[model samples]
Every structure is written in C-alpha cells, then in structure tokens.
Target: MLVAAAVCPCPPLLVPAVAAGAASELADARTACSDALAVLAASRPDRLVVIGPAEEGARGVHPAGAAGSFAGFGVDLTVRLGSGPGGERALPASLAVGAWLLDHTDWADAPIEGLGVGTELQPARCAEAGREIGASAERVALLVMGDGSACRTVKAPGYLDERAEGFDAAVGHALGTADPAALLALDPELAQALQAAGRAPWQVLAGAAEGTGLEGRLLYEDAPYGVGYFVAAWS
Candidate 1:
C-alpha cells in the first residue's frame, strides 16, 4: 500500500522558526521543507495519512515511530477537520503536522481515529476517511492542503454545491486521479500577502490540470515557510 496525501494552509512556518530563533526564517523553511521531504521520501510509502483542519476536536491516529529513517513510514491516521469545539481555522498547517506527529512519533500505540467537521463543505469527513483507507488499501494517494476556500469549503455537498466557479474543477475531482504538484513557498512579503488575499487555488489547480490527465507541477521555492508536501504511492 502506498499513500501520500499532503495539504497545508499553515503550521510549517519554518518549523516554528526553526524552533524559535528565526534564523533567516529558519533557513527558508528548511529549504522548502527539505525539498518537500525529499519529494516525500522518494515515494516510499507504507502508511502516512494526514488530513487537515483542527482546533478543538483534535483527532490523531497512531504509530509514529521512524519518520527519519522511514521505518515503514508508520503513522496510520489523524483526521480532525472541525465543527465540534471550534472551526474556521481551516488548515492550520494540518494542525502543526498533527502536532508534529504526536510529539515526535511512536503513534501512541497506534490506532486512534475520529471524524466530524461539518457545516458548509461536507466531504463527509474526507469521503469517509477516503473510503475507510481505500477499502483495505492497495493504492491510495491523496495530498490535500487547503486553498480554493479550503477546497470549496470541504466538498461532498453532492459535489459542486459551493460553486466557487467550480472550485478548481471540484478539487481535481475530489482529490483523486493523481498527478498534482503545486509548490509555492511564499516569502516575497508572503507572496504579496497571497496576492492580496486572492488565495491562489494552488495556481488554479495547477493550471486547470494542464493536459487534462490531471498531472501538474508548480514549485516556486523561496523555502518551505508554511509547509506543503504531498506524496502518494500505492502498490
């Protein structure tokens, strides 16, 4: 099974300014989150699920052991969108990388899950947690990070209800069909404050999914500031 889904709206503010020194903005968000986690550990996926949006109803899955050596890429699930205690914080860096993978790995004995977050955009808890981990998995890849009004307010309202001009073709067909890469590590004064708060929909869904097959790439590196990385592969 190979799955890598990453979405970011904040929380990699250069890893809390490199643990709070702000050395040149933590060396440009640690060189763009180490080149997007070295292209997500070069597509070596065993299990790494991280969904977004959380403020109070914090939900976190287990197994966070070897994130360094990539020991089986453990860290099953953690989906806490919003709506219970508080909401609207969208993707706070996916809850600061799910609280830095539950305070630096070990998954807390693994196996912890929950889902809610509903009010406007209803992905129904991210498509029922992506079809319950894609029905026992063999291949699953979904890296979604807020934009386009946090993915058209979280989709699922019978697909395309929010209708922000078809929110990037409805979030590239509900974050599937693979082939999406949009990296813009803002720094030019936060990319002119996100183009004066236009909130570029990841460059308009990577230029309308280009050739139409839905493979897109846009990396404007100023260095990984507010962190964004999505790598998925399943076999």
Candidate 2:
C-alpha cells in the first residue's frame, strides 16, 4: 500500500541547468517539489517508485541506479535513480526528470526504482501497473512525474486549445483532494486531444492509493510556457 505520494511535472526545465537563464521562472515549482519530497521522506517508506510518462521504446521498469542524462537537453548533468549497480538501459526523459528531483533532494530513506508509462497507455493497464507497484513493498512511496495540458496558449508545445484550462482545473482539483475516482474518470481521448501527458501517470497513482486513506494538498499549479505544471503531496 502507498504510504505517501508526490505529484510533479516532468519538464526538463525544472532543472536549473536545463532552464538556463530562465531557471527562476520555476522557483516556486522547485520549492513545492522539495516540500513534496520531504513528505515522502517523512513517511519512512520501505520502497520508493518513480513513475512517469514516456515514449514507446522507453516504457518499462528502470532499476535503482538506472542512469539518466540531461545532455540531450544540452546539460552535462547525469543522475541515478538511487545508489546501486547501474543499468545498461537509459531512463526515459520523464524518469530522468524524476531522477533529477531525487538527486536534488538527496533522497536516502528507501530503495528507489522507476517505471515509465507510455502516454497512450490505457487507464486499466496503468492502474494494474500501479497495483503491482503498491504490492511490491510493505510501505511504498511514489514520485509521479508528468505534465498536464500542453496547450494553454498559442506558445504551448501543442498550441492553444480551448479545452486546456478546464481540463487542467479538473486535474488540479482531483489531485488536491486525492480523489482517485475523479482521476480515474478522466477521459483519455479528451486528455490526448489536450496533450495532457499527466493523465496516465496520475491514473496510475490513483490506482496505487486505493484504500490507503491518503489525503492530498495541492502545493502548486501553474501554466508556464503554456504547459500545465502541478505539485501535490499525499500522505
């Protein structure tokens, strides 16, 4: 069962080096993420699983010490999920961001692992995957990484979509309240249309938290660079 969970955006921009001169733009998000991670540490979980959306080839399990690089984003930084023997396979971008966050927090409370879910993964499969994770350890903690709508403005990666704001709002509310049913109820097709990458990962979190009685607090919600980024903590 999940002892705690932290939800955060997966944008590479969260890394100061990746963001370069604009790093300050995400200062609040970074602080919120820090606080969320603190919550995870406080739970004293036996295991930590980092879940994030990924491309087809990147989907699957990433072991502790799995390597991730920001070099692709023009940064020389490299991160590991946690200290252990490294893996041959590279982590997906989303998991890489998750790894970066873990490194930033110097997380040492539990053994860490990562799962990269495809953006198009069905809700059922996502939930099933989450259930498996929840059962993997006596006290599990999750660091979920993915972005909300990417079309809040014309400058957004997917460009402006009229439905973006409403979609993000609903997601924010659901996360803030730790409403698994509401998260599971998100329309996949609509989410895809709005370019909401968080849909699948958030649903996975919902599945893992079932019967855990966790309550959530929304730490941050914003549309920066036209993409919705959120940070929430459940405990």
Candidate 3:
C-alpha cells in the first residue's frame, strides 16, 4: 500500500541547464517539489516508484542507474534513476525528468525504481500496473512525474483551447483533495485532446492510494511557459 506520494511536472524546463534563461521562472515549483519529496522521505517508505509518461512501446520498468540525458533537448546534462551502474537503455523524456529531479534533490529516502506508462494507456491497465507497484513493497511511495494540460494560453505549446482551463482546474481539485474517484473519473479522450501528459500516471497514483486514506495538500500550481505544472504531496 502507498504510504506517501509526491506529484510533479515532467517538463525538461524543470532543469536549470535546459531552461537556462527561463530557469528562474520555475523556482517556486522546484521548491514545492523539494518540499513534497521531503514529506515522502519523512514517511520513511521502504520503496519508491517513479511513474511517468512514455512512448507506446516504452512502457516497462526502468531499473536503478537507467541512463537519462537532455541531449535531445540540446543539453549535456545527464542523470541516473539511482546509484546503480549505468544501463544501456535511455529513459524516456518523462522518466528522464523524474531521474533529474532525484539527482537534483539528492534523494536518499528509499531505493528507487521507475515505470513508464504510455500516454494513451487505458485506465484499467494503468490501475493494474499501480496495484502491482503498491504491492511490491511493504511501504511503497510514489514520485509521479508528468505535466498537466499544455493548452492554457494562446501561446501554449498546444495553443489555446476553451476547455483547457476547466480541465486543469478539475485536475488541480482532484490532486489537492486526494480524490481518487475524481482522478479515476478523468476522461482519457478529453485529456488526450488537451495534451495532459499526467493523465495515465495520475490514474496510477489513484490506484495506489485507493482506500489508503492519505490526505493531500496542494503545494504549488502554475502554468509557466503555458504548460500546467503542479507539485503536491500525500501522506
């Protein structure tokens, strides 16, 4: 069962190296993420599983030391999922960002592992995967990585969508309240249309937290660079 959880966005912009001039814009989000992780560590879970979005065929376990680099995004920064020796497989962007967060925070809470869930993954499958993770260890915690809608403004990456604001608001409510029903009820089709990368992973979180009675707290919420980013903690 899940003893704690930290939710954060997966944008490469979270990395100072990748964001460069725009890095300061996300300073608050970074702080919130750090605070959330601190709560997770305080829970003293025996295991941590990082869940994030990936390509359709990229769904699988990313063991400790899985390689991650921002070279594709024009940066030389590299990170590993854990302290293990490097692996040949390069993590997908979302997991890469998750790894970067761990490296940036110098996480030593618990042994860490990663799982990539496809963007269009069915809710049932995502829940099943989550159940497995929740059962994998005695006191499991999650570091869920993925971004909210990217259509918050006309200048957003996906451009303006009239429904974007409402979509993000509902998501924010679900997360801030730790409403598993609301999370599981999120419409996949609508999420895909709005370019919400967090849909699948968020559902996984819902599955893990179901019946666990973990209270949630919203630490930060913003749409910097036109992409909805959030940081929250549950324990």
Off by over 4 Å in 2: none
Best model number under lDDT: 2
List per-candidate RMSD values in Å.
18.1, 0.9, 1.2
- Candidate maximizing TM-score: 2
| lDDT by residue (tens digit), candidate 1, 21-104 | 554644543343344333434544443444444334333332222121111223233333211333333333344444443343
Q: What is the Cα root-mean-square deviation between model 1 and the actual structure?
A: 18.1
Model 1 CA lDDT for position 155: 40
Per-residue lDDT for 1-235 in model 2, tens only? 8999999999999999999999999999999999999999888999999999988777888888999999999999898999888678899999999988888885665899999888888999888888888998899999999899999999999999999999999999999999988999999999999889999999999999988889999999999999999999999
- What's the TM-score of every candidate structure? 0.24, 0.98, 0.96
Over 4 Å off in model 1, which ranges? 1-4, 7-144, 150-165, 181-235
**Residue 123 C-alpha lDDT in model 1:** 27
Alpha carbon lDDT of each predicted model: 0.32, 0.92, 0.88
Per-residue error for 73 in candidate 2, Å, reads 1.0
State the TM-score for model 1.
0.24
What lDDT does candidate 2 reach at residue 95? 92
Q: How many steric clashes does model 3 contain?
A: 0
Order candidates by lDDT, high to low: 2, 3, 1
Better of 1 and 2 by TM-score: 2
